[model samples]
Target: MESKDLKFEEVNEGFNIKEAIDEAKRCLNCKNPLCVQGCPIEHNIPAWIHQLSMGNIGDAMSIINEKSNLPAVCGRVCPHEKQCEGHCILNKKDKRIRVGKLERFIADFDSNMGLIREKLTPKTRGKVAIIGSGPAGLTVAGDLARDGFNVVIYESEPEPGGVLMYGIPEYRLPKEVVRREIHKIEGLGVTYVTNCIVGQNITVDEMFDQQNFDAIFIGSGTAKPKTMNLPGNTPRGVIQSSYFFRMVTLNNNGSVGRNEVPVKVGDIVGVVGCGNVAMDAARTAIRMGAKEVYIIYHKTIEHMSALQTEYNEAVDEGVQFLWETNTKEFVGERGRLKAIKAITNEGEKVIPMDKILLAIGSQPANRIVSTTSGINVDERGYVITKERPYGMTSRKGVFAGGDVVNTPQTVVLAMRDAKKVAAGIAQFVDAKKLLEE
Candidate 1:
């Protein structure tokens, strides 16, 4: 699809009722359920499939909710090929099950039918504050809120979904799905405070002293984009993939206008990196009317961190790839990127490009920890935490999880860690409260 012709159409057309039923019937309902084992969040794959096959979609959705708070978002974005469906027994026969599609189907069905009933708790426990409204933070908030903890999420952005609302494009993961999932969290009695920067506006000690939160869960994802130290990085046309994605998502969601989205049509775009974010950047560029889109990766195709399905989709959409190529510098004219100079095994080559999107990776923002004294971070800036207490940080009442601790992992994997951290927080806060009593 040409950029001018590209509507914000959803990439994956959701499964219809009949298709969902047929797919549910395909599940062998393996006793071992390797799909569940393979999932980072350990969704009850077999149980959900059984419920779906029996036409008990609400029950299936409930089963999915037990493990994941963002089923709809995960259904759209999670790389099932590398995770859950990757281990399906049917894969031995070279026929992998459509696990992602089915999960998406059930979740969408429940959402459309308004079958989601809030899971209520008996009484409120101690209060917990979650930083960031991304996957990990939202998961922790949902888990703790359901456990009767007064959970409040603080998001620095205007919206609460974090990366889901900013970094991901609407074509891949719709904003509506993100909004619906967030609504479920809010229904659980969790409060969200937008445009609230914890380290800046309110310090950790201040939260402990004034707010009196029993425990703090830091899920502020790695927002700082990792850049190539190559020359011309400061050029006008050189931009980080995260920033570009945020602009596009915000524009689509009406937070910004279309003119502010950047990357106009007919521009030659080059994306540096081979991860899923790179693919998203390349694809988004295509939809934004880029005449040519190329993904440059230093490693071989096999070593590319992006899921094969994402790569295939990008290729299908006419996005080009230059594997085994390392960018040497961003060649530009008058402070604007004009081309990219790269070195491959063949020799030095220069590709003319109007825009350079850096999707290399990201590092955790240090502002929060650097300003707060009690918390401890390693030389590399990752928070120091013990496994027994799961997500507990250097401070006794503080916990950290998700991309800040583990460099930008998949959304579901982050949620898995968040769930563990939530449990740990509950135990710690409960014990502390009991002692106080």
Candidate 2:
């Protein structure tokens, strides 16, 4: 499809029934599944594929649900090229099994067929307040809610899914898929409170002191984008990729209209960085009508942090790359961006452009830590937690996980961290309850 035609449409057309079964049959069902070992959440790959091969897709989905709450989302956006499929034995023969495609197919099939059986009731465990409805938070809520914990997710945005809702492009991951996955969690009796920024509207202390939540899981993801100290950073068209993506997603969902995003038709776009976010920004810029979209990175292509598949997709979509390039300044006229001056190994060059999107990276927003006392964060602003105790923060009875505790990572990795912290929280809360008894 042409770049101009890229809308909030589903990117990969999911597998149909026959395709799913055929793909599942490709799996040799290795006795020792290295694919599962490579997965962050350690999903039962062989088991699920075996079930699918047996024509029991519902059972396959149930097996998948044992470890994943956002299978459909992960199936769509997870960098399987580097993880599961990359480690597949089939790759040795230059024939990697299409694990991600198969996983997505099963999740999509289950969703369409209403095959996700409810696994929990509200008759056990105490109430837990989960802050931030991102991957980690949502995973914790889903797992705990399924274990009969009254899980309540608090989100700052109007929607429930954080990065899944805003950061990811619609063409890469459709909004409907996110909504469907979230609806499954809601079906498990999880409550959601949107438009509520925790630590501002409700302090962490209040969650325990006044609200009396038995436990708390802080998965508030990193929100503050890092920026270059280059001259003219304050120019009109110099924007962060996160903000740009948020605007694009909102515009696509009718939360706003076109022109709300800073980019315009026929514009030349310059994207700074070479991560997945950079690829997303460049592709989005092209789709937004940019005549040309350039990804400017200080490192070589091999050093790029973006997944190989993402880089390839961007190239396929006509996105350009300027490797080993560093921005010096953004030149503007009448307070709007007009061109960018950058330095490469060869020397300096001025690239005329209408917009510059910054995708350097982001840091955890420390607002919650600032508002709540006793919690400790590193000098770099990451929450400090014990490894053995898993997700316990500096203060007792408080747990933190996901991006807030580590560098910005993939959704599934963050979910893996949250799963560990959930076990920690369960242990801590269960011990406390025993002591009270």
TM-score of each: 0.96, 0.97
Q: Which RMSD does model 2 reach against the true structure? A: 1.7
lDDT of 1 at 353: 86
lDDT of 1 at 154: 90
Q: Please give the CA lDDT of all the candidate structures.
A: 0.88, 0.88
Judge candidate 2 at residue 436 and give its lDDT.
83
lDDT of 1 by residue, 90-180 (tens): 9889787788998899888888899978767854699999999999999999999899999889999988898998988898888999999
The pairs that clash in candidate 2 are none
Best by lDDT: 2
Clashing pairs in 1: none
Off by over 4 Å in 2: 1-5
Give residue 186's error in model 1 in angstroms: 0.2
